[model samples]
Target: MCNLYTSLYVAISVSQHISVYSIGLGPTELLLLTLLAIILFAPRKLPELAKALKESADIIRREASGSAEKSSVEDKERALKEVAEKLEASEKQEKKKRRFF
Candidate 1:
């Protein structure tokens, strides 16, 4: 039901952000990629290209570590609040059952 969709939505949203700052490439793979970029582009252009890339990476790193952590903390708080509400509701039901019996 609705809860399943909600859970999936939250999970997918979080995971998309999890990879925002990373390509998941290992050191060897990253080395190869850099080598390929060097081969494909001119040496003179490489420094400018690298400077732009570094700036972009710094922005991404800052966003991921700082803003993302804050949002993730809020999401966790929201989820925990939901669970607490559910538990409280269930406890109320149990109390009603006891009173009826």
Candidate 2:
């Protein structure tokens, strides 16, 4: 019975340690990954790749901004048309009221 208890305790302790280890990594892991990537790609190619990525990101941002601006302008035009229609309808109603009175 004592030997069984000892074995169970050792197994539980080892499992707990493994769970803690597998939980997640921290900044050291990220730094190691960056270092590995740098070593694999070298310094010269990294700058060109980074520039291309930045350009692509800028293009996407510009397109998104332009679409947002265009939609806002369309929204404003629709709102103005709605206001004009409402004003015309109210003016007609006023004329009818005057005729009735």
Candidate 3:
């Protein structure tokens, strides 16, 4: 009974160590999902499905990159406007100083 208990404890510990919490699929899971996809979808339709997925990924990437570029351009424009405003203010200060002198 002691030996049986030790074996059970070892097995439970090993299983617990092997278990993982993850949001992403491992290779075996991915392979099974691929097999399931093959069984459910037609061979002729696979290419079209793959193409649609690629297009969607590309569109998402483009939108993300475009937003980054847009923000950068906006930052540059804001900085330029600030500098122009400061320049105008300094020019006005210089003109007032000239009038007093």
Ranking by TM-score: 3, 2, 1
The lDDT values for all models are: 0.65, 0.60, 0.61
Model 3, span 1-101: residue lDDT tens: 45444433443333233322342555566446545654575555544554565566568668989999999999999999999999999999999999999
Candidate 1: C-alpha RMSD after superposition = 17.5
Candidate 2: residue 75 Cα off by (Å):
1.3
TM-score of 2: 0.58
lDDT of 1 by residue, 2-95 (tens): 5444433433333343443367755555556556665676555555566666667678789878988999999999999999999999999999
| Candidate 1 residue 42 C-alpha distance from true site, Å | 0.5
Minimum summed lDDT over a 10-residue window in model 1 is located at: 7-16
Regions of model 1 farther than 4 Å from truth: 1-22, 72-101
Q: Which stretches of candidate 2 lie over 4 Å from their true place?
A: 1-37
lDDT at residue 50 of model 2 (Cα atoms): 46
**At residue 88, what lDDT does model 2 achieve?**
100
How well does candidate 2 score on lDDT at residue 41? 57
Pick by lDDT: which candidate is best? 1
lDDT of 3 at 16: 35
Residue 27 displacement (Å), model 1? 2.4
Per-residue CA lDDT of candidate 2, range 16-98, in tens? 33323344745455446445545575455544544564566568668989999999999999999999999999999999999
